[model samples]
Target: MLEFFNDTQTIHFIIIVGSMSLFFIGFYGIATQKNLVKILVSFDIMESALFLFFIGLHYKVGLVAPILDKHLKTFTNMVDPVPQAMILTTIVIGLAVLALGLSFGIEYYKLTGRNDISKMNELRD
Candidate 1:
């Protein structure tokens, strides 16, 4: 059992499965929840899952970080930094969007006295 857990392939598989499950959990929340705050949280969960999936899958057991140094001077044998950078940028953007969404939700709740998506009919003609 320990040996099974020690394999690199098994670790990668676990990461993939875990992230996918997390994404679906978030999707389920978005599909079924009626509260504005809950929906926004669900979206955030999905974003986190994607970040985990991207970063986890790109990692290798032996590859070094993509940093230049005297001993490690080449890009060879180093993990690709593109995915890490992209995920970092995505995380920043996601946080901004999440904050904006939550603020909007708060304002909506303040104006309407409710945050349920189905109850938001103030704009109906």
Candidate 2:
């Protein structure tokens, strides 16, 4: 089992496992749960998973960030910066979406006087 602790392959394995677990948990929360707040939270979890997967795939030990400094003229096995930038955008978008979704959920609860989806569907009558 000690061999599994090696970074050459274990890091990627962990990244995959983490991503899969996140997806499963998020899916379950979104599909089986009826609470709007929970669904939003699940969405947030999914976003986190994607970000983790990306960062993990691009990560490398003893590497520096792509920030340009007067001292560090060139990169030394630095990981890709594109993924980091994309993840940043994704994170911001996720926050905005979660904020919007939660506010909508709150409004929904206020208008209907209930947070349960089943109880809110009496409008057809």
Candidate 3:
């Protein structure tokens, strides 16, 4: 049992399960929440879950950064840089999107005095 718990496959499975759980929780929150801010938060939660999965998927045990140096000549156990770079880009874009969404939500609240999605009614005007 101790060996099983310490196995890399078991660890990977646990991380994958945890990430999936987070994604589902976020999905459920998005489906049930009426507040715009809560929905945005759910989206962020989902994004975080995706990041976790991506990072976990690319990670390798006993691996160093994929940087070229004089001492490290062989690329035998260097971590991939593509996923890390992609995640960084995604984080920047997600930040911009979240800012824009919050600003829109703020404007809507200012205009209508409410932030609930169900309460928004624009057709009657």
Determine which window of 10 residues in candidate 3 has minimal summed lDDT.
Answer: 1-10
lDDT of each: 0.90, 0.82, 0.90
Give the C-alpha lDDT of model 2: 0.82
On TM-score, the leading prediction is 3
lDDT of 2 by residue, 1-125 (tens): 67666674777888899898998899888888887777778888887888899988887655778887998887766789999999999888888888888888888877777787756666687
lDDT of 2 at 11: 78
Per-residue C-alpha lDDT of model 3 across residues 1-125, encoded as one tens digit per residue: 57777666777898899999999999999999999999999999999999999988777656788887999898778778889999999999999999999999999999889988887779768
For 43-92, candidate 1 gives per-residue lDDT tens digits of 99999999999988888878888899899877898777999999989999
Model 2 spans > 4 angstroms off? 1-4, 69-71, 122-125
Off by over 4 Å in 1: 69-71
Residue 36's C-alpha lDDT in candidate 2?
A: 77
